[model samples]
Target: MNTPRLAHRPVPPHRPYRSKEFPVPDTQTQPLDPVALHRDSVVFNALDCTPLAWADETYLGKLAASGVTAINHAVSVSQGYDAAAAALVGWQHRLAETDGRVFQAYGLDDVTRAKETGTVAWFAGFEDSKPVGEDLWRLAALHQLGLRFMGLTYQNRNYAADGSGESANGGLSRFGRSLVAECNRLGIALDLSHTGERSTLETIETSTKPVLVTHAGLTHFVDSPRNKSDLVVRELAARGGVFGLAAKSGFLTPDGLTRRPGAEVFADNIDYLVELAGIDHVIVGTDVGDERKYSREGMARVRRLYPEIPIVGADLDLERIHPEGLGTPADLPLITELLAGRGYSGEDIGKVLGGNLQRVLAEIWDSASGE
Candidate 1:
């Protein structure tokens, strides 16, 4: 019998899945310990595009407090090759500056080593193919510099494909097919978070490796174009891919701009994804970033950049962008707490937290170079 490419890998009994060690009161009046559960699990954040310059001592301290094993850091997006290369080099220097607090991760072994050493492993990713710019050699070079996952487009059209904001819903271009094939050859996973719906489905069908929607929600909850349809979600799971439930309130509910969404909002989305795609294909990708983005100035700047969503209206409160109790990576354990309270088994929670994403990466990142 052929095993599913991204089948669930259960945690060993010897390993800590969850226990009653750290007692916390639950709605069911049972003992549930989310702290210990999160501490013991290999939590991986599939998408984090926070600027590298923000990784100062306090920021790094917050990351250490988050208990995350690894993160797919966006090195560049919506930019050309030169700018993207500079951004990548800048991240390398920032990682070096961490002084052993952070480790550059290229594979599962590196993730294991980071978790063992109590340091965060960071792998580089690109949110668009504009950086490669008609040169497959440039793509290989970026891969050499540690680009593990890449999207075909951001929220706009590029040389490869139309983005989610495009009206035409055009499929992948000839160059886009080449991009998908090159990503497969170079051990890089494809991401479809911001690609057009048609382009996303086509890329999944075109690639030999499993694709990832690194940070997105479901249209079943929020009717925004940024959210995936149930059809896309089902197809993604059928192809052995994983879906990351984003924590952005704008994509969680229709009234998100009017009020503060609590962690329950995220829990509900997680529940929906699990029910629709099964436990083994669901994971978390809280898209929280530097606190400055919540400020009026930052919000205005963002509005100017991507006007398609028009999320930041004058009347909308910036504080409502991220769900309460999950405003940053430091609060990620709350997902574990919420899931546990919802009666999810410890092993299943482990898969949702990071194991599923870990398995998908292992399958997609497989190549001869083994880099």
Candidate 2:
């Protein structure tokens, strides 16, 4: 019988599936006593989530155990207004279902609240702006529904701008620029994570408030269409924005080594970003999670979007998405543990973990909270 095919088919270019891969440092299972530092520190994730099924109590338990203060949860995707509204409301209901363990975060204070109360703060974001459709007025209502940010594109062309893969790299459309102003006015942060480099830089130049590339890597490391260039990153820094270092191995390394990249590799990426962008501008935004089943389903869903190619990610099993050792929210302590071992000062480590995001959020959100 033909062997069952792997759910994630490998694509050309980075054949990471080849048995002989780059030699990674040994420490696949190295155990470390959990660091107590994160407990007191506000451990906010700029972008990432693999929240458990709402019905599962383990979801709430795992979050507390992981010490996650907040995350930019992707509650809606390329959806219509009604569907997106349902998602936004559903998330609020999820938090209520948790009986106050997780709270809806609208401002920097909400994050502080979560940190102090030992709960996870959920800041809702959209992976794309399609949910708003042609009507600019919809964004106002959506913002009221607790939608905090929206990516102009999902690495593909949209009404706002060209995604990473689009040949139309002409930057933001006229309507796109209009929406940017409205978002600035309405306190909805603009996330450039999945947008084209040209569009991203253009958005930065256009925005009055700081824009975020929530879960991205520098092209200086792994040069991919999805990664940002030095020019773009420098611009983002000069504008007082933050580049959230991602944990996905593909973004971390060009070889597509997400299968077994240890937490040390993630720490090294942090070090590089800090060197390039300085500590205050660098932060963690791991697009990872612990739940394998949900993650696999998430991948399949994304793949359907690009039926012609669906080449968003390297071909690897669902397990590679989170990487080994650094797989779940609970494993987050490992990064802090490694950072401490690397001689990072508590203040610096604290900034890398969440303090940086706190600062940016305050300026961007609070300054624009007028709307």
Candidate 3:
């Protein structure tokens, strides 16, 4: 299989973490105050953050400010074997830098503790499982090192399977099948967010343990390659898997240029998935990291360099400053308010926030406890 040349948006260079911290852009949008409710709920922003390259007290403050109880932070992606290995090393160093201010969630107990203590419970995840390479044996070692969620592919084909960019839609490679079994045995949840349609559906059938498409749009809404088909979503829900909704402009809209549809569109997605796949299977995964605005020149440069993937974000216009609500971590509470307005009860809201993913985690992790 030919691995397509992927021109990806380069991660921006490190800068000083800004403060004065995002004042809610839409005060008149909702009457319900979700601060206390968000604090109480077990919020998990699946695959939201890119692991930091540098560490400091500012990083600590930004991490805490998300108000998210837990994050399946993608520490590794778009790297070869050596760089991927080093990514894990970097994550370990950052985790150590927290000095217990952050907690690692290996199981439910750790997650509960993080919720109770008001600390960020970060469970390590990778956007692609290519890091393990052909050494399926290494999965256990990485799991021991705190890797809990792993995607089979990211944007393009790997040794495991084809990603969305591949039109062939190949299922698991021989090694990919072995990988699925290893992940099931090791308690690493198989994340199929960027995986191709065939590979994702096949994995759903192959894995004994329930899987999760932790971050992607719904084809039922936008009919994009980056989103899942309705049939796939239904089958996943039937087999006890969870589907997490992502917060990306292109996947969410036609032109992929605005964030205004966030509240209504995201709420409608949750409701649609709930009706089709059931509420138990729907969850949250803002595929974006932090909300850092890019300059027009920066956006233009990205468009010029990576023509395949354009400025599918709010920063399409350099001078235009639109209200980016759910575009970042801070605007997450708006989800709660929107869901409430949609007539979701507290119990249902809890499940959508993190309870669904929480259940999937226990099922996978607890079963592999003896490992």
Candidate 4:
């Protein structure tokens, strides 16, 4: 069960922050034009666990207010098939009850409407494809339920493939190959975020349609087991696939330990990917979860363990939090502005925001329908 070790890249010299003491600016010196900033820029959220994170309707409303074009709702991961199916059913019920407020995207029209109205279009995606069971027919059933995208596995070995963090690091299983073909037939886009290296490469070679690594980072930047190699990034891009940059703090830094400065670090990752793979293949896929409930509980637990420094609620600043700016979904405009400041053109920004993902989705959906 020996996993292949990732080849290391020389760590870039850490850039000195403008102000290390204060990560976030207190006030905006120049106001960003919201309308102008949002123009041609479509935010494609690769992962959002808000539904599972918040009980308050206000939080959901906050997300809707964010002007996000689309979100890939993770329905299954680290859960059994039955549980995964149940989660999908529950999400569908929520969407129906919400009455298109959080509508499910089954085709291009759904995405079009999301752009026009500014409502969040939810695409059912399984964080792990373990729920497909041993039978390939289950893929069709899941697709009928609006499961458009699926990862082969989560952070462990499954029937289909081995995860990136798994010790075995096996390639796609026989059942995994069948599942990939079925996904091709059904028009589902295979995601290889948490999948092992061998499995990911094998999947890229096998799938008829383009694939997506919905949320991940470069192992060269951060030595985390979850991040992919630069070689894999190049291979995926060459195959017409999209590599969605994840927002997870650990995955983006070199040490995979300390939290790097928010927007700056995010920009660095973007620049790195653009250097390796063209700008057209890079997209933002923030795997941010709702921290409203968990933060307090986690803080309380931490206080019990280490009561030396009293960490109060005031110390929690969502604005400067994470290496990828945090302030619910509403803060996406800031990212666009940051990208622009980094000298990226409007077209490049658009591709990073949503165009890249749209291309892959359209390709996969068309292939599925043709079958």
- The candidate that wins on lDDT is 1
For model 1, how does the per-residue alpha-carbon lDDT over 247-288 read when each residue is reduced to its tens digit? Answer: 887788777767777879888888889899888888778767
lDDT of 3 by residue, 209-317 (tens): 8899988878866776678988788767767788988766555555555534445767777788889887778887877565453456756765564343323553565
Candidate 1 has its poorest 10 consecutive residues by lDDT at 10-19
lDDT of 2 at 233: 76
Clashing pairs in 3: none
Q: For residues 274-328, what per-residue lDDT tens digits would candidate 4 score against the true structure?
A: 8998887887677665656446556565446433212222344333335545436
Per-model TM values vs. the true structure: 0.89, 0.84, 0.83, 0.82
**Which model is ahead, 2 or 4, in terms of TM-score?**
2
Candidates 1 and 2 compared: the better one by lDDT is 1
Q: Candidate 2: give the clashing pairs.
A: none
- Each model's lDDT: 0.79, 0.71, 0.72, 0.71
**Error in Å for residue 306 of model 1:** 2.4
- State the weakest 10-residue window (summed lDDT) of model 4: 14-23
**C-alpha lDDT (0 to 100) for residue 139 of candidate 4:** 77
